[model samples]
Target: MSPGASPWVLASPDVREETAMHDHRRIGRELDLFDTDPLIGAGLPYWLPDGGAVRHALEEYIRTAERRAGYRHVYSPVLGKRELYEISGHWSHYSDDMFPPMDVGGEQVVLRPSLCPHHALIYRSRSHSYRELPLRMAELGGMYRSELSGVLGGLTRVRAIQLNDAHIFCTLDQVTDEAHAALEMIGRAYEALGIAPSRHRLSLPGPGGKYVAAPGMWERATALLTDVLDRSGLPYEAAEGEAAFYGPKIDIQVADGAGRESTLSTVQIDFHQPEQFDLHYIGADGVKHRPVMVHRSIIGSVERAVAHLIEAHGGAFPAWLAPVQVAVLPVSDAESEHAEAFARRCREQDLRAEVAEAERGSLGARIRQARLVPYQAVIGPKEAVDGEVALRLRDGRRPDPLPVGEALARIGVLVSSHSTALWDDGDGA
Candidate 1:
């Protein structure tokens, strides 16, 4: 195993290969992705082995994509000083959803309900130049919410959330383009995860004391986000009072197997936070000017994303993200040696593969157990002698026998490309 890798990496914890369409709660239990304990309270669930692997893969993927897109990653504490939220106006405008403040050593702190306040402080850490206008900072960090017990069914509504969050501090002129790019990033991430947006939402301010009182800022922020959606030609609904306490946002919504919808990703134009935090960048004229803070999330939260994946794909994740990508089944104990060797070869290629244990009953039973795996490589006496293997795909396509090397190559292609296609004509299935 790689350094710092989870001990669960070796086991990968096998799950049923095929799943019927069900809500994430059912699939999460059946697939060993996550579970909740009454002692730990509602809205807090712990990830199991298989679930952790999927979440880790997603975090790494988003990290890589963010780096390629010029986002500087950062780490921030889940707990923030009570004064921080007060300064950012969360205490006034959004305290209802926050946990009660804790007094430690005469200092009050609370689990952060959002990352923007902390990120705003980071932006204010030092003087920045106009050339550094669009400083994009990202984090796969934890935030907490005080969700009601009734609303906390599964990962979808959680008290502790691992958010794929970022903030881009850009000049006024850069706001529209940055928001547009952010929306596109969310779209690309959905495509890679085999996810589809149910609809796009322009979440605008409505009648509320929760929203910032600045009407001009609200109008400008709404228009900027509206321009992004309009230019993209993607149809969207303007949801009143759905905007953040600070600004208007573009919410990318996804529906579960049960037809329930939730926001999976978001891009917001925040002029409120910069002014609240007194964030500024020196302009070409050497005068200090406020920088707009653009808030965005690609895959909102790992827990919720996994929940959606469990339902959307029916637990048959894409090869790259699947808990168990390959299951090598030996015809009998006679071919178990070849099965183990093939499994080792797959592991060397960094693919998640496992050899079926002989104690799991007959070869037919083992194959049946592995039906949810994206690819099943079957080894038998004849194939062992011929140095080839039969392939069974999750989509029920069995290609002609091929050398193990060729099979591995094709599997690697699909996994690395993050393609949704199960088979290609080139594979000759």
Candidate 2:
């Protein structure tokens, strides 16, 4: 075997079968990630303990990265008066995707379909000088949309979702640079998670889409973004009709096991919303000027990203992201005390580890159970007596043999750093 071929290698057919698009629903359950309840309605998911843990970790991870990139967290209400969408041109273009308004106090109120309209309202609620040009407002806001039942699948398609959504408001001149920074930050996020950047396509769309208020402005915006992607050495493809009604976008596409591409993220440029909302900032000359807006979602939707991660990792997540990172098994009653101590140490380090007491069944059976849950570390007397623990990998059967302290330390570092060593195929193998 190659010195560092992933410890979790599977037969080529197994990899293909596991990643196939049709297998995601089954894998979600097998991973103990999430489930759907018919009574709760279609296109919605109920996350179990492990699934919820994964979502929380993802939120913390993205939030930290956003803050480091200078994004300010903002919260917006889940429902809004019907007028907000009108002012943002969403009513004219995307009204079909929005939940129908309900009668409340003789006024129409609808669940929010997107965060941009709210962000625009926030911008208009304040008067700004040029210094406040690039106002980066980010939110993990829950949104509701009227999606077709047939299209919903697990977390990939949902009526209700908490989106890692953000909008960047910048002057025309600052647009390119701010955009570059955001894209680079997003790329880094995927990298840390062991997601291969090359798997995605950066897509640009044409100007003729409906409700695109100004063709000239659209052309200019798309050109600027095209230049940005080129300068960054990013490869992209153009899709004629994929642009949003108000602006053009860069669609991040990924392929499933069957090799079919699906959009994973979106970065859009808009020169129209500012005009529609009458948004402005005072320029150096003290005259009012509209700030350009870029609507971006690194992972698009939390639900969708979760689905992709499940399929990509084939239910065996990395240490940092795994719900149960380690499981300890004592060889017999005599080793139970030592096993408990080991599990406690792992917990103290913020690692998710559990101790399994001496059981009635065989060791092989116990081992199978451990593998079923797929722990990152599996410890027993064999390991304890040898002063080592068996490090289980999602993709491998043979655990790493290492001293207890050393194993814990290594796994701790990996989890803490959210490391994914799998992506480091330097030889391009």
Candidate 3:
């Protein structure tokens, strides 16, 4: 074993193939990704610079994905009036899930548990048109909810989180198509992240139980989703009563490092909220009709997604998502200038690259350190004196020589693709 390889890294096969949660925790702490600052309180993570980059990348990825699918991004506050929750019916259904209110002036304010109410208000801001049948609004929304300390686990479960939330207001006639689009978007997201479809599950809570609001609506919505899933040929299993209080949902679950299951994406149909909020739009007939609302999170929350990614990739991360994709080392002081120049070229190609100062340690020692962080270490040597680099990948790969310019161009293309193609493992059969 390599000197730095820990038992945790060897005994765990997922870490070598794909990161599991336990592997993620070990790697996260070692990489200084996030920390629980006891002084800062519990269930909250203070993301270090490197960890923050991972979080930001997640947000960026979701934002771009939603935008391409006709979703507009928006922002909502972390706090709202107590009445807001009541109006949205969240208080009655999920009172226990929420934090207690804060006395403000003469009224009570509660930390927002979810962004649905705020997004609903946005929908009510003006009279919508049938031509704008599907108005999709999204937010990398920060929300807070009180939780017992025992339940918090690194970034997986947090007191505060930035939910990749979106609300789609579409006519009842547009429901199936809009839902199809949303589910497609979710599949594409998981695919891009290299998450096997077998790791993806679409959960639907079966009927014959209480709280299936508006029987007709529930039936229609469930049928639509079932049809979509079947037509898409995506493998999924239904879990009865797994639907949200408002409607049935397509829950996308992925296996974490430790072989545990967790929701990574979701698409929910809401028939209750629109009626409760009296949300409507002018139809082609100039008559008012209630628009159905669809809620989705391709990657549920940045904090949780980061946790999943860390575990999924065992902190090694894919080339595109790696915090430091490439680390350049100058074998000798004479190579420092050349190494710096080459690193800049890599950066210009949109690759995350950095130069490790020779002052830090021996070139070999730094090379090993780079592997610990699991970066592809590029060493500058005599052969690199002519603007070339001795490239090495993380997994103990042999070195190769390439011109600085050509390497940068290739790296840029690879990173920009942001994903690799592999056979769809469709939910582990």
Each candidate's lDDT (Cα)? 0.87, 0.76, 0.75
lDDT per residue (tens digit) for residues 130-221 in model 1: 99879999999999999888888789899999999999999999998999998889888899999899888888877858888999998898
* Top-scoring candidate (TM-score): 1
Per residue, candidate 2 scores C-alpha lDDT tens digits across 1-429 of 221222234447765665654466887787778898889889888989988988888898989888988889988899999998887777888889999999999999989988888999888898999987689999999999899988787777789988989999999988889878878877887877666543333344444435556769878888888877887788676666567787777777765665545667778888888888889999999899889998888877888787777777766666677777777777677777778888888898888877766674565666666664445455566876787776666555454577888777776777778876422223421
Off by over 4 Å in 2: 1-22, 197-209, 372-406, 422-429
Please give the TM-score that candidate 1 achieves against the real structure.
0.93
Each prediction's TM-score versus the true structure:
0.93, 0.87, 0.88
- Clash pairs detected, candidate 2: 8-395, 8-396
> What is the Å distance of residue 309 in model 2 from its true position?
1.1
Range of the 10 consecutive residues with the lowest summed lDDT in candidate 2: 1-10
Evaluation by lDDT, superior candidate among 2 and 3: 2
By lDDT, the best candidate is: 1
User: Is 1 or 2 the stronger prediction by lDDT?
Assistant: 1
Per-residue lDDT tens digits of candidate 3, residues 33-124? 98888898888888888887777776777788788888888887888999988888888777787899999999999989899999999899
Candidate 2 vs candidate 3, TM-score winner: 3
How much RMSD separates candidate 3 from the native structure?
6.7
